[model samples]
Target: METQLSAARVSIRKGKAKPFWYGHPLVFSGAIQKVDGSPEAGECVDVLDQNGNRIGWGVFNPHSDYRVRLLCLAEENAPDYAIQDLVKRRLEEAVLVRRSLGLPSDETNAYRLFNSEGDRLSGLTIDCFGDVLVVASSALWVEKYRAEIEAAMRDVIKPRVIVWRQVNAPLRQDGVSEIIQTISEETVTVRELGVNYQVALGAGQKTGFYFDQRENRALIRSLAHGRSVLDVCCYTGGFALNAARGGATNVVAVDSSAPAIENAKANAALNGIEDVEFICADAIEAMQGAEGANLVVLDPPKLARTERDLHRAIPYYRELNKAALECLGTGGLLFTCSCSAAVSVDLFLEMLRDAAHDAHRRISLLKITRAAADHPLVPAFPEGDYLKCFLVAVA
Candidate 1:
């Protein structure tokens, strides 16, 4: 008689092998055997070595190329833990880390509570904006723990509303349905660096606003006082709004996305700020035509999707940076950034150097910035790290 488990059994194939690998137990093989001991797919299972010791546990998807995505590795016969327990423990740990950093104060209620793999929570991320929490799920396990995650958010931080964003492309590839569910209130107000932002949890870009750039925006504002500033790809006018509020004489924001331009205008209005101008145009074109601006910001979207896309994306960055350099006045500031994980910090700096050379100007590095404290990066996993900003002065 064969041992029984709830997961399906998938045939393991090796290179040019005819006989299927058998009697090999995996903690999560996505392979389930029937009462008669047959194979099936898309089930969760535990994998074990030939010695009958548990190796790892994961969800199995035979239809997709990946047979198993391990969630955990634990010894066999361990007490079965509910998904809720896992979510609660992770949330508590995240909260503890933030408190240690002295975040979540009266002035700034917006910060990242969980950053998916960064926080060791695997496929779940939660961003808190004032009284609202935006949740993005990228794996089936996270979807399974949805209710528990929401409960933890309420019990731990007591946010006014929790918005669920299940439309991530990776989740759909895993055969998971996408649905935006509002777990609590409809509106939430969050303050960041003394600026109050009104966010509608039901409808907004990834988690309502761009919390990752919170620190960078504040830094730009500090340096932009009395300067003529230009913000490229200024989503929701984060940098632009901050520049104007920081006493910049003039601030112009540009983006190709119409919706983004609209949102930037609305954000400016929300702050009762009128010194900034929003332009719905390609940033590259805007940079080429921009003149008399001493401070230029070039924050393009992720141009490189993967390692294969890097070669092509490098030229685009070089061109954009070169254009910004050409537009900047003498002794002007250039704040440029790349949010591509494939683009390393060293490579990004080299590209900027190359751009400066091509534009016939020398630049002195002012400061280097990364994602805010909320978006922590694990040393072992570089993929969790993205968002690199460079502050330079054209000479």
Candidate 2:
């Protein structure tokens, strides 16, 4: 741990400590009354109430609307609140939680090791693809403490390669690190539930794979026996391969990305599962052409990037889902999902209802699922629960 230093302090606006008190990790700019000292961007700052009472410690960012990301409350705080110590403890805790669930077992070697706010390391997410660790950081504090973070991860997981990536950086140059780029290599083959996949750590979407859907893929396997599955937006075919492994009569996987379709085919070959038809086409158009699949899964990318995008996104979701529901045979099953944190379950449910009505289909909700155990959620942070899956029986 680093030596204790007298850090800068920021006072919360009068009566604005309620959310922080309730365990919400974010403090918006509007909630801050004044800064007691001049702190550099991504500097550790002590959070104080209007009355000068210590509230907690947090990372401060002047540029972002979310000005402070709370690290730990004073009551439950650690003895040494150093960046390295905090990161190591949090990483170790996350690993232990996953180990408790028996993840990275004989059947699986890929999973989320650390989920940003969910693991209390706000704006930092790390995923494991076998020996490769893919990191995505939104917090500038991570850049300053990058060496510490890597060291802690090495102590816990000895990953062969660590690729650093950024999401939504203000500047393109700021998004990437030259040192990390020089050290990191590209692709690695990983397994999940006995399924083989080739993951591109530096190039692939959101840490190369969606390990959060591991349990959901198992659910697809359970329900796919003897059915013809249609997997729309099947990036590298996570669900389609599971369906094939589960003895689906036939599996048709479609994705707009040519590379993804090619990778899906390679994964099928790697798994020695030959009953899949990989198609590179727009998911909406492909869903429109579906031929009465007994099982249909619609897992698209984040359609609504922010709350402001809901108007445009809702209609897109409705249309895509309507097409999928229309292609489902009577008594078929549908595993539909939306990964947009901006989109709430209530709003998604409403859109699904409208889609079913448009498709002239009767739907019975069978199960509501979310991300796998590795991506744990903070009860106070609704944004932490980004994945929403609806397993329904359609007629």
Candidate 3:
């Protein structure tokens, strides 16, 4: 642990310490009243309250609207440590939490090790795919101490390959350019609940696989016996394969990405799952075409990245879900989801109601679930719970 206190002191505006005290990590630029010292971009800063009382420690960024991402709070006296120590400490705690939850066990080797602010490491997410670890950083502070972060990961995980990827750099809001790329040598094969999958590592979407849906896939498998299943947006066929494994009478997986469809085919071949059909097509159109799937999985990508996107996104969600509901019969089941943090569970439920009305179908809500245990979220922070999965019984 580095023993030097940050040179800069940031004072929060009047009455703006409530959320900070409540463990919220975000402090927008508007909440700051003044800066006591000139701090460089991505520098650690001491956060003080309106009355100049020490609140905690946080990472500073001038270019971004988010002025500070709180590293940790000072319950008593502020700790004398650098950002590296905070990161490593969080990493160890996160690993212990996952281990307690039985992640990377015999049945599963792929999962989210650290979930952004959920694990209190704001703007940093690390997912483990077998021996490979994909580290995604969205904050400049993370980039400033990239070496320290990597070193901590090495010390904690000792992973075979660590692929660093940049995502949504807020510093690039100006005319500055942002380069987004991933470094991976080869695809890795991983297992989840006894199902084997060929993960495309960094090249695939959001670290190649959605391990957040691990428990949801298990639920699908348990309910898929003797059903005609349709998996839309089947990225590498996670749910589709699980459905087939669960003894689905007929399985059809569709995705717009040709590479994803090909990879899904490879995964099917890897598991000797010959009965599942893989299709590369538009998901909404495919859902409209398939009129009689008893079990349908509608797991689409993040539609509303931010709150501003809800207008355009709500219609898309409604249309997609309406099509999925239309594809189901009287006794059919529908597993729908929204990965957008901006779309709250209540809003998603309202959209589903509208969708069912549009599809002219009666729906009974069976269950509601979020991400798996490994992807734990802070209940105080609503955005931390990004995944909203709904299991509906169509009648």
Clashing residue pairs in candidate 3, if any? none
Q: Considering every candidate listed, which one attains the maximal TM-score?
A: 3
Q: What tens-digit string does per-residue lDDT give for candidate 3 at 136-201?
A: 777787887888898899988999988887775443641125666776766888898998998766
Between candidates 2 and 3, the TM-score winner:
3
Order of the predicted models by lDDT, top scorer first: 3, 2, 1
lDDT over C-alpha atoms for residue 219 of model 2: 95
Write model 1 residue lDDT over 4-118, tens digit each, in one string. Answer: 3465323332231111122121222223221122324434555444434444555555443344554444533332334454456668889999888778988688888898767
TM-scores of all candidate predictions against the true structure: 0.82, 0.95, 0.95
**Candidate 1 lDDT (Cα, whole model)?**
0.73
Q: Is candidate 2 or 3 superior in lDDT?
A: 3
Q: List RMSD in Å for every model shown.
A: 6.0, 2.3, 1.8
What TM-score number comes out for model 2?
0.95
The C-alpha lDDT values of all candidates are 0.73, 0.85, 0.87
For residue 377, what is the lDDT in candidate 3? 78
Candidate 2, position 290, lDDT: 79
